[model samples]
Target: MAGSKIVVRFAIIVAIFMMPSLLWAGAMEIESDRMVFQHKSERAEFISNVHLKRDDFELWCDKLLAYYKNSQLDHTEAFGHVRLAQKGITGSSDKAIFDQKNNRLTLIGNAVLEQDGSRITGETIIHDMRNEKTVVQPRKGGRTHMTIESDKAAGTPLPKAAK
Candidate 1:
């Protein structure tokens, strides 16, 4: 009975501490298998199948490291099967870094971005969401790649082939 009471108390304490983070983005929530926070570094590391959710976007990764400034999200580094989703857009990469100072997201290793029917792929991609700009770069000696497909091309009825 005493052990169960202690567990309940600990659960309440954790919930209280996590409330502010959940409220950061109008009730944006983050969850993971484990989390470690370092006050001296002003950073928090979430490991194992991390998920982050908010009104405008969602992010998933195997691990995430968030650095805060003034108790606000300054930047983040996500590793292992990083994925980001927003309205009409989806992006994936092996690793991703969000640079708040530059207002850009840098994706590395088999990076890809897809919207509508078009797709952009490369070893590295830098996207500036505020400005709606993207720069794709090759890794080492590789080449950037893109495929643009029109909706009409796939949706239009084809003419019947003559016999």
Candidate 2:
């Protein structure tokens, strides 16, 4: 009877530790060819054609490593053919990191962000999700590039110039 009581208490404690993470965000779904979860380290590794979706955001990558703290999402690292989409915006990079605490996404190496026919490319891109701000950084010897579509391109008529 004592051993059973101890086991019940242990189960309750474990559930308590895991509750915060499950409730911190609405829901996060991940699919991968293989997954390895380490409860002691509070990390999960998803390998090969990984797809992750949370709310309206989606990400695809060859490999992803997600870390947790206090049973809540701490951050995630994505590598190889990293691509992300949310709302109408899309981003691609060689590597990316999503910091849950700060609500920021950092894209590194051949980073490109596109939306509504406009595109920005840089060596590094920092997107602050909470602030809805983005910063692009160029490579050491290269320059960041951006292409913005004009109103006319969207079929909006231009105002006539004074005669």
Q: Output the number of the TM-score-best candidate.
A: 2
lDDT of each: 0.76, 0.82
Q: Give lDDT for model 1.
A: 0.76
Worst 10 residues of 1 by lDDT: 2-11
Give candidate 1 misplaced runs (Cα > 4 Å).
Answer: 1-27, 153-163
For model 2, residues 123-152, the per-residue Cα lDDT tens digits are 999999899899999999899999988767
> Pick by lDDT: which candidate is best?
2
TM-score per candidate? 0.75, 0.81
For model 2, the superposed segments whose C-alpha errors exceed 4 Å read 1-22, 153-163
lDDT of model 1, residue 158: 66
For candidate 2, the lDDT comes to 0.82
